[model samples]
Structures are given as C-alpha cells and as structure tokens.
Target: MPYRHTIGSRTYRFDDLKTLLARASPLRSGDVLAGVAAATYEERVAAQFALAEVPLRAFLNEALVPYEEDEVTRLIIDMHDATAFASVSHFTVGQLRDWLLSEAADAEALQALAPGLTPEMVAAVSKLMRNQELIGVARRCEVVTRFRNTLGLRGRLATRLQPNHPTDDPRGIAASLVDGLLYGSGDAVIGINPATDNPKAVSNLLHMLDAVREQYAIPTQTCVLCHVTTALQLIEQKTPVDLTFQSIAGTEAANASFGISLSVLQEAWEATLALNRGTVGQDVMYFETGQGSALSANAHHGLDQQTCEARAYAVARRFRPLLVNSVVGFIGPEYLYDGKQIIRAALEDHFCGKVLGLPMGVDVCYTNHAEADQDDMDTLLTLLGVAGCNFIMGIPGADDIMLNYQSTSFHDALYVRQVLGLRPAPEFEAWLQQQGIFDEHGLLPASTSSQLLKQLPPALR
Candidate 1:
C-alpha cells in the first residue's frame, strides 16, 4: 500500500517503503542520478514528514528488498533482536529520533538497543536528523572492538596507517609506514591498498608488513586489501594475514558483483581466525564500504545509496569486524558531488554504523575531480573527532598516490589529536612513549630531541 501525507491542498504519495526511503534521503547527486530522489523540494519534505510518522514496527513488517530475493534482507530479518527492540517497539520513527537525542538514551541503553534495530529503521531516523543530531547520537553509541589493540573507547581516536604504494615496493611502503608511526598513527591498523592482486605480490607485501611489525613489535594490526578469495589462497599458503580485508556493499547482488557472498566472507573470517595472529584480541576482520557502491554496480535494487550503505554495516556486524570504515568520498563526484555532500554522508555513515553496533571509522577523503579540498577535510576531521569516531585514515599527506585520492594523513591525525585531545589506541600509545616518539602526555616530542627519527633506518630516511 502507498504511504501518503498532505500539506494544505497537496497530498504526496510514496509508492512503497523503498520509495519512501529514497524520497526521504537528504539530497545527493547519487540519489538524483538513480532517479529515485524526490522530484521537488516540497515532495522531499513531504516524504520526511510522512516518514517521521512511520511506526518503528512497520520496518520489521515491510521488506524494502524482498525476503526471497536477497540474502542480506534475510540476514537482517532473521538476526534482529526483537527482545532488545521491545523498549522502543511502540515508538514512531520521529519518536525514536527524539528518544535518541534525549538524556534517557545513554551509552548503555544505546548499546543494548543496537541489535534490535534494522538498517531500514536506522536509515529512516537518520534521514530525519540534522548533522549535529547525527553526531550527538553517534557520540553516545560507543562500540569497542579488539584486535592487537582496543578501539572505540571514549576519549580516543585511532588511525589506520595507510602506506599504500603504487608499485607495491617494500622499501617505499616501509618509508611511509615509518613516517606514519613516528607521527603516532597506526593504532587502528597498518592497512595497505596494494596496486596488484597477484597472489605473489600480495603475499610479498603482507610479509613485508609482518616483518616490520615483528621487528618493531608495533602494537597494531596490518592488512593488504585484496579479494577474499586471494586472502583465502594466501592463508592456505601460510602467508601472514593480520586482518582479512574486503570491500563490501549493502546488497547481495552488489556483493555478488564483487565476486563475494556471505558464505565467502564467513570462509575468509574463519580462515583468518585459525591463524591466531593477534595477541591482544581475536576480532580480525576489516571491511571497507562506501555510499554509492551498490548503485554504481547496478545492483542497488532501487534503494537509495545511503540506505544501501547502511545495509553494508549489517553485513559487517555479522562477522564482528574490528574495523568497518566507509571510504566516504573515494567513489568520486558522481556519488558525492562536493565537500558538503561528502561531509554529510560521512557523518551519516558513521552514525548509522555506530547505531547498528559496529566500530565505525571514516576515510575522510575525496577525489581530485570532486569539489573538495584539504579545508573540507579539516572540517570533517574535526567534526568526527568530536563525534567520537573510532578511526580515520593516515595517508602520507592526506593523499593516496596509488588510489589517486585525498584522505586524512599522518599529520592530519596529529592535528586532530592535538586539537581535540584524542589519543591513539592504548597499546599503540604506550608503544609511542616507549619509542620516544610521544611524551608522557601523548603529545609528540620536540623534533630536535625526538628519538623516533633516529629509529628510522638510513635507507628509509
């Protein structure tokens, strides 16, 4: 049945739950490109007005993507914690929003409420929220995961030391890795986006990272972002794999386009676990998601991009991933046209992921073609800091040479840490102190007297 709302003499109707969601979403070029956006501003407001009245229970009853057609939908439906949801079962989407921002929805309550919520419900409430509302609610939702180090603890922000090399050169990667570590980054993980998927190349890069990690005893995880199948093959070959990495999407079909399924992910998760790599904790999966992946793959099944992005979190939560980051602006101008859009999407993605009980992070980034720059990144980085985001990318200088996009850098991480008084993961923080990179207060030591630079090998320097 269609849902309708009225303003004066005008009545707006949404054909279905999916249509309602699409029309309710904050305007984005991707939604417009999908031809699912509200035709007019008035219609968008009407949709939001109508959506606010939707009963939270209605999402449970109505399937946005048919149950028979999508495994992701099945996973979401079958795994929902109805008992946890009973607290807010009677509330409308708008009421839920009010409750979320209310003093009653503290950290403990939000944590307990996570498993009960569905991606659709979370996405719907998000559509009704302003950016600050998104941040405030997300701040209260603390999601901690462990793998070599604890993450998502309040008063801390982690950094993924992304030492991506265009040619998979070990020395070049090592230089960048050392640079990031010296800057007090890499507490989250030392993840690499390799230029080649060649099993040999992937194995070599993993070994290089492992060698350095072992040599320095860096208290963090490392990942070579390759296909799950390649990771499985490497695992079978006894290659050192710290975190099994994959780029996931919201829909089963979109994941299928990436040659992955829920089963494949389970296989990879199990394979990585059997290695017993982590010393601090066993949570050992890393996932990267973005707003427009499903739509870009032509497998969105008519849902809006942000909702699709939230659905990917459903998948991430299943495996209990240590790190689930949205590469927010990496998809380019088509999905997020400018800095403002990218910032909004980043906040939304973080808020949605945290609400669903995932340790969420953002790759504060943009392609060169997009209408964004470092100033935009500075704004987003500072906001996410205040929002209590789990982590951000630490590229060499807020630029990924291999991927050819701008992301948060090692220096950028320091800037945020200094300004916001955020620290790295506890384990990595101790390591920084031990290495004389950071003083007792977790601030970097003076460059002249710093031992961190001296620790770097002559070749790396």
Candidate 2:
C-alpha cells in the first residue's frame, strides 16, 4: 500500500493526491476539500496539499482552524510561493491567537499537523512573509571562498574523471556531485539527453532523476530535444516525461524552406502537441534551429540572424499561449561564439518579453573554448543574465565534445558557485592547494591555456 498522510481529519492516498494536484485548476476549495476527505492516507493529504497550485500556507490558513504554530510555520516553508502568505489575513495575530486558544484545538493535533517543525523553519517563513530579501552577501562570500580553494591544478585534476558512458552507476556519481553543488542555488538547470540511439543514456538519466528526487527534492523540470524516433519511442513507452521536441539543424537551405513555409513550423508544433496530449501530461519544447557555427556557413545554408529570428517568431506567435505561459526551453547558438547577436535577436524579436508572453529561458551552450577563463565565463554569464535567460545547460565533463572541449568538473563547479550563490567551505583553501593551481605567490593564473582555446572552433574563438 502507498504511504498515506492526513491533515485536519482528512486522509488521502499518495498517488491519488499527486494526480489531483497535478491538475491544471487545483485551487477550487470544493475540489481540495473533497479530495482531502476522500483520501485514505496521510501522505495523500500531504501530497494533495503539498503539490497544490495555491500556496500551502495560504490553503492551510483558509481551510483549517485551531492551528498549531509549528504546522503553520512548516506549511509556509513548504509553500513554493511563501511570498503570497504575507498578505493572507488569517496569519494575523488575532487569528493566530484565536486558533491557538480555541477549545477545539488539541496539542496533539497541532503537533501532528506540523511534525518536527523547527525554529529555523519558522524564522525562514516569517522573513519570507515579511517580504525581506535574505542578505546575499554571506552567500557571495561563501562562493568566493570556495573558488579561491579550487584555483589550482590539483583541484582541476580531481574533477577530470571521464565516465565511460552514460549509465546508471556512472551517471549517479555525476548526478550526486551536480546535485550537491546546485541544490537551492537556482543559478543552473540540468538537461538530460533522451536520445533513442542510447537507451542506456535514458536509463542513466532516470537513475539520475531518482537521485535528484530522493536527495535534493528539486521541483525543476527537464526537456528532451531529440529526433522523431526518440520522441515516438518515449511516448510509446508511456514514460511520464516532461517536455519532448525536435532539433532542427540550421543550414541555408533549411532556413530558406522554413522561411517560406509557415505550414512546416505549424505542422511540427501541432504534431508535438498531439504527441504530448497522447502521452498524458508531458509538455513540448521547440527549438528554432541547431548549430549556427559560422557566418558563411549560416549564410550559405540560408540561416542568417534574420531568418532564424523569423522562424522563431513564427512558432512563438502561433503557440503564444502555450509557449508564453508554459515551461518552455530554447537553445542558443551552438558552436558559434559570435552568434550572441543571433541569440539576442531571437530573444528580442520572438522570445524576449513578448512572443511567449511569459519569462522565456534560453539554454547557453558550453562550446566556447574560453570557458575556463574567468573573464570569458563572466562575459557569457553577464550576457545571458542580461538577455533574461532563465537557466544555463552544459555537460559535466571536460572531454565531452558536446560541451565544446570544456572541463566539466572545474568549470561546472566554478560556474555553479559564481552564478548560483551556493555556500563555500573554509577548508576549500587546503583543497585547492592540494590541486596545485596556486603558484608560490599563492596567485592563480588569470586565464586558461591558449593551446586549449585554439582547439575550439574559430566561431567560438
């Protein structure tokens, strides 16, 4: 039997609760109350309430009475939108006191409602409720300190392990490290390749997902951009995948064809949506084109900035409602460092603040050879940040060609710390010195090796 949980005399089954909450319109009080009452277990109640579209604290405030302080605190912390709770009138002192002092309230009931709630949780919720931004200086200091320790060759080599292939055992090692580095620091997002050619890769990704779900409990989604074969395979298998879509290669011929035919883009969009609907609850992500590495290459292939943006806008305009409000993903220029303008044009013209009518996220490719240089990384980071991208994606190893020959271990760690605001360890100094990046003067190099950078495509250079 599935684990169950209860809240306010209502019991629910876990799976049922998940399905109910996953529904698009989950805020109706009658629906919630009925689901809660029909629930057969406590976890069901918890999941239903936990995954509700409305904030958990707000729901609890409106639905329950004779509340426990600790339960209210936990609900606030568990709420995805704790910011919404402050305006809720039920949390006022009078209401709280009334709920606390009411004869219907029992000490045991309060304890059960918010089991193991801590003072720290209460303080977090309280601060969030008050609309106070937590001081970010301490967090920044932590990242810098960590970076200082990881500045040496020994540190670099420690992270240079290459997995033979994407499989459960090897991928778990990667996922654990990545998850540890990224948890709670919202600067980076992970994407898994669900290519049909390699079932092991998909299996490995599932293993990674399990680890992520079990350990960090992150709520972020994944997007699969693959060919038709992989898309159909995943759909046929009835996998509860998140988003699946196609990857279009950018050549002059394809670009011209795309320009001439709205039907082509429309058909692709309709087909993806149809697949998604058939797959139960998965979403579809659209990409404008793949790999615009050279000006001449793009021009020769009919995929200049104008054409690229035009195609993106065509798709964005057609599916504005779905693309704008939905969780969508787009890839930026791959194999082309100078393609930032193309990226910017696409965003400004089709994606930026309008076509999607929502915050559109652009995924940055790790193909730039200068990824190791702090200056280069910083420039890209600043560009993406300014471009209003929601997240960045890259592989985890240096040897991965897909990552543009970048060292995944060092660069990935550094990028996460710099952009995501994760806390650093004081002992990281000893760790970095062990890696030998520091000279006798304790100063690290300002840039990566030119030889390494030379290996990158000229467009990326």
Candidate 3:
C-alpha cells in the first residue's frame, strides 16, 4: 500500500509496502520510533502481546492473511507506544511482509497453510530483521547509553565528592567522574578536547588519554581539532590526528565557503577513520566554535542551534555510511554565561531533537547551581523530556544554588532527570554524601531544603 513515512516533522512517500520497508529498514534508528523497528518481528509482536494482553501468536496464526490495513495500523501504533525495543534485533522489512502475508493468506487453516510457523519460528525470522536495524541503531544508542550508564543517580551524587575547586587536570577530573559513575560498568570512555588553537595541543590531548585510561582503569581514546592552519600543520606533520578541520564558528574560512563549513567537519571526521585504518579503537572528534549565546544566536553563521544542528547532520550523513561509530559530540551550551530562557528554549526548540537525528552526542556546558523557581524547573524538565535529550552537563549542588547562582545550569540538569524520567544511578545516595550535599542532621541547605519540601510526594513532604 502507498503510504507516507514520517520522521519528526519531515515526511516522504513510498510506492508500496516493499518500498517503504526497504527505505525504513536501513534509515538509522536514531530516534525512539526507529528504535522500535530495530527489534525482531517476533519481539515486536511479543511487545505488542505484552501490551495488548492478547495471544499474538494465535492471532497471527488465524489472521496472517486477509487482515485489514486499519487493524494492522492500530496494532503497530499500540506496540510502538508500549514496547521498549531499544535492544531488540532481528525483525526486517522482508520478514514483516512475509509474516503479514502468511497470516492474512490463511487464518483458520493455520496448520495446513504453514504448519511449522511456530512462535519460535516467527521470533527467529524477526530476529534477522532486528539485526539489520541494529546496524543503524547501535551507534546512536551507544552514544546516549554511555552517558546514561555513567551518570546514574549515584554518579551524579559522586561528583560532589571531588574537590569543588577547579584543577589544572580537567581530563583527570572528567576521568575520575567517569570512573566513579561507571564503576563495575564495563564500557570504553572516549574524550575529545578541542580547547586549543595549536596543532601540538592535539598531540598533548592524545597523550592525556593514557592518563585517563590508567587512572580510570578503563579503555580510553582522545582526539583534538586545532583551527584551520593548525589542523593543516598537524596533517603535514603526520601526527595521526583523529579529526582536523577549519573552525566554522568565527573564521573567514568558514564564511562564504561551503568547504570550510559543516562539510569540512565531515571531511575531518572521514579523515580520522582513514587514520584508524581498521584498528579496534574508538573514534573521537570535536568541532571548535565561539563561546556563549553567540553560536546559538548566529547558528548558521556564528554557531547557533540551527547551524550547529546542520553541521552535525552533515557530519552524521558522511560518517554514518562509513564507521557506524558513536564518537562524535557537539560542545558548548555554556549555560553559566548564556541567558537561561534562551538556552532552555534552544535546547527544547531544536538541539535535542536535532542531535537525535544525526545519532550523535551533545555536551551542554552548565553552571554548578540551580537558579530557577520550582515551577519553572518543572516546566523546563517536562519540555526536555518531550524533546528526547539523552545527556546534560551542569553543577551538582542544591536546588537553590543552581537556581539563584546558576539558574540556567541548575534548572537544565534537574529538568533532565526529574521531568525527562532518565533513570538515576543505583548507588546515587553514597555519591551525594561524599559531596557534603546531604547531612546526617537532616539540616539540608535552606535553598535545597525549601525546594525539597515543595516537591515532596503528596504523602510525605
């Protein structure tokens, strides 16, 4: 049947189920909707069964053939809402078509038409489709899952234990936090530092990876991108840079030059993969731009949300066909410096959803406090949840400090967890104590204590 395929606000038409399934099957499962399709047909069916509480296997056996399109659409919608097909892999376009055709062709004559089509058999076929979907979804999911696994409630709490005072060892600080948050969690930690205008800084950042690996006791990788001339110098030196590019945010090279725009970011990323040459190391890269709301305000020109998103898409489109890795991330949503309302609106309006599309990661800079009122926090968080933000950065402190001292940063993180429903780490309480955030006397800081009282569950203020 002819149908329209929709991803967010964009839509495309397919001539038939075969055409639709083929296009949809391989379109990277970057968002929740695609993630569902990444699961096996049997698993998808099982998910539906779990939700609908109907014997899907029996229904398939009886209604495989001659099922109405409306009925199928309803079933698919129900399954989409109820199941977390994030990890499933096996279902495919061909399998879905075959299953539907098989079911619809002969309902009551199940035994005679396809006597061997047992639940296990169906599940196996679906698994094949899911595997294909995983080829696309895995990278996107990896980027988000890494952050989620690392920053469980316990991880957030533990950040307080570190010396609040700034240190010369930013990488060390990041590594330590990763180690604590992801302890007993076995995943690679990759860091990309774009903090220098010198090519040598890229080499310096690479050397720092060793420190992060040794200190954290986990595998690690780092990449550095120097501005245009510096990047060209590094390439001449054969420094094995992961990504080298023209700085798109403030330079004349990026202006009026598509080659220096997001396209260059993609080229640099592609170059990084070539440098790897099939090694088993993670690919890490970063793009440098100006600081504060300047980027957001002039995204297309100066690095605002729209321009950042466009660049990200360009990079994703280029790399997706090659590596299928999740090492790319966008930096600098400097909340402490940017206006609160502007940052919040940008995040909700475009950034989160845009990142999801490219299947990459976002690293928003945040203050060490919360500055907004409880009501505002609630509204912001609710909006973020709807926008599908996977990672957030900010200070770990009481609600009041976050609101008053660092309102933008504070509300951003709180909303990330409280409103968005991202799960906290299992050992979050211990981490909280180490930070001196919560005391034995139950004498919480007044700002935090007051907000806590206001947000208490109906039964236990």
lDDT (Cα atoms) of all candidates against the true structure:
0.92, 0.31, 0.32
Residues 1-461, model 1: lDDT tens digits: 69999999999999898999999999999999999999999999999999999999999899888999999999999999999999999999999999999999999999999999999999999999999999999999999989898998999999999998889888789889888887888988999998999999999888888878887888898999999999999999999999999999989999999999999999999999999988878999999999999999999999999999999999999999999999999999899999999999999999999999999999999998999999999999999999999999998988788999899988888888888898888888888888878875665555733565656644465
lDDT of 3 by residue, 1-461 (tens): 34453444744554432222223322211212212132443333333322222222332333221235322222322333113222122333234334433434232332222222222222222223332222222212222222212321212210111211122144443443343333211121232324445556665554454344444333222334346455555655766554343333222223324235444555555555556522333233433232222233332221122222232323333333211121111222232222353233334222322222222222332232323344544454344334443333233332212112222233344445444344333323333333333343222353443322343322221
Model 2 stretches with alpha carbons more than 4 Å out = 1-189, 194-196, 199-217, 249-283, 286-303, 316-359, 365-374, 394-402, 405-461
lDDT of 2 by residue, 318-346 (tens): 33212221111122223233333323322
True-vs-predicted CA distance for residue 55, candidate 1, Å: 0.8
Q: 254 in model 3: Cα distance from truth in Å?
A: 5.0
lDDT of 3 at 61: 33
Candidate 3 at residue 280, lDDT? 37
In Å, residue 232's CA in model 1 sits off its true spot by: 0.6
Root-mean-square deviation of every model: 1.4, 20.8, 17.0
Better of 2 and 3 by TM-score: 2
